[model samples]
Target: MTIAVSTIIRPSRILTALVSAVAIMVASIGLAILAGRIGTLGLTPRVLTGFGALFLAFFGFYHGVRIRKILQLDIAGAGQIRLSEQREKRTCSDSDWPHVGKDMQVMQLMPGSTIWPCMLLLRLRAEDHAVRVVPILPDSVSRESFRALAVAVRWLAWQSDSQESSYL
Candidate 1:
């Protein structure tokens, strides 16, 4: 009998969002105060402060409603993968996806960019031509976890290949 093993990995997105909101709020308040100090602190700074406050409010809302990342993987069988992220939760499984993240990838991040530094983005194919982008390894995390995930994917792919060949 073939045994199925479940592997779970969680990522930090809600906390990240909260931190970003706080950082933006601080910047907004600082700039607003600086602008107030001068008779005319220039239009540029005022505009920036407005944008920052708007973004801060948006992130604050997200932070309040943010949920945890939860992924369930069954690598021993038909590439069953379940994901619960933000407000979208769904499960996908098929022999076609023998490997859950066969196309998993990562991108190097820079400071002051949309994503924090040293983070990797793993892209998984979702339903109907859409893609699910997951951010992992927030900052300077070891690559061992990434390797482990890759190995599990490869093993699942092998299982799928063998199953197909056995039928043929």
Candidate 2:
């Protein structure tokens, strides 16, 4: 089985939001300064305000880099997730797109579902800290991919059974 590790890229929305926020804040401050609205505090306050904005912008840039650099290894544990056969009609869906290293926050989204859909059972405990996007997108993650991921994680975990793995 070719178990390829998928790398999580920083969400474009995050970068866009951060950049936009910083830009707006800077623009507003610049406008105020241009309007000759400097307070009695003088140049010190302006300098401090500029520093604060710079710090915030730097933080946003660094955060994006951190997100891209973080690497997680999924290792399986002895525990196995159990699914009910009756819940074959229900599909495991998530409220939103899942980040790379986060908890599985999935919900049963099939309407009038008497049982969980069998298609998503392979994803049961397959990925570590990986949430399913099936809820948001019907085919974001494939069943075969999930199953292979599970098997790979379990194997890797077993190899490092003596010590706690970084990604469990």
Candidate 3:
């Protein structure tokens, strides 16, 4: 007899969005500085650089805010993996989130025992997927969910009739 337990992996999109906003703000400020310096070349250069910097700032902020509303990570139980729009079909994959999630798939998500809030790697046995290295996001996911995910993975491993298992 075999019982299947379900685990939902949903890191807060709100949190990621917030981080992205910060990045956008920093980049915008950096671009503004660059424009100010490049303005020394000539009035034409100054106007062009200033316009470009403003465009970058606007584009960055617009995209950053938009992602929060659409970011989706539906990797729950088996066959439940789903990526939202703007995530799958995109030209410039400058946003690291999409690329990061691409390598993940539904599988025996053995997130490891003793998986501290330090590092994590999820691998799929399917022919269509590759290993995804999800680094330590101590605060990206809620503490409880992270622990629960770890427990689920460990439980599956232990139930697989493995003798050399330790999850305490």
RMSD of each: 10.4, 15.2, 11.1
lDDT digits (tens) for residues 1-168 of candidate 1: 333333345546655665667766766675565557524657777676656666676667565445345544343433444443322444333444322454432221112222223454445554444565555553212355444445544454556568779999
- The candidate maximizing lDDT is 1
Better of 2 and 3 by TM-score: 3
lDDT of each: 0.48, 0.38, 0.46
Stretches > 4 Å off in candidate 2:
1-40, 79-168
In angstroms, the error of model 2 at 26 is 5.4
Worst-scoring 10-residue span by lDDT in model 3 = 1-10
lDDT score, residue 55, model 1? 66
For TM-score, candidate 1 versus 3, the one ahead is 1
| Residue-level lDDT for 156 in candidate 1 | 49
> Residues 54-89, candidate 2, lDDT per residue (tens digit)?
566567656544443211222223322221212122
RMSD of 2: 15.2
For candidate 2, the 10 contiguous residues with the lowest summed lDDT are 106-115
TM-score of 3: 0.39
